[model samples]
Target: MIAIVTVLLAFPLGFFLHNRTSAYVVYVAIFGYSFTFQTLYLLRAWVGGDHSAFSADPEKLPLDYLAVTGAIYAVGFLLITLGHRLGAKRRNRSLAVDLESSK
Candidate 1:
């Protein structure tokens, strides 16, 4: 669910910003971290064994889930950054050409 939303937003965000750095900051850092934290919070709640749907009282907090989320977020950031850089370079090149021709 969250993954679908994140993937759907990534391209439009990149296109809307049309700036590599800005896109990365907005999409990867901001949105990515937001979703990650939200998931963690939900997981914590469920782990507390209060939720009827997913009740589980563990002896310790799930550090492994934290590690997995961290790794997934890192990978997502890397992939998004790479794609942003490539798209930005192409768009910038075209803009430069247009500007050069206009002058």
Candidate 2:
């Protein structure tokens, strides 16, 4: 569901941005956390049990889910930044070689 849509969007963005590896890594991280959170949410909804002592109410959602989502978003942004830096480095090296040849 949510994981599927996230992958679909990430894949094309990766290709278009020429950062497939970073994109895939971020995608995996995002999907992994999202799935885990969703599972916990579902369990809390159905099982009516609180596995963690932090929450008094079994029906209450965990605050960690929000933290996980934020972490994923940060990872994705970092990946994009790294990918752009790598691509720029490669481009610069190629340009330097071309310039030297013309000298």
**Among all candidates shown, the one with the greatest TM-score:** 1
- Go through the candidates in order and give each one's C-alpha lDDT: 0.62, 0.58
Predicted candidate 1 versus true structure: per-residue lDDT over 1-103, tens digit per residue: 3455456666566555666577667766666567667777777878676554233655656576567556656655665666676667767774433436554
Error of 1 at 6 (Å): 3.6
Candidate 2, residues 1-103, lDDT tens digits: the string is: 4435453555344544655665667676767777677766866755666554235665676678567555655555554555556666665675433445553
Which residue runs does candidate 2 get wrong by more than 4 Å? 1-16, 19-61, 95-103
How many residue pairs clash (N, CA or C atoms closer than 3 angstroms) in each of the candidate models, in the order given?
0, 0
The lDDT of model 2 is: 0.58
Candidate 1 local Cα displacement, residue 63, angstroms: 1.9
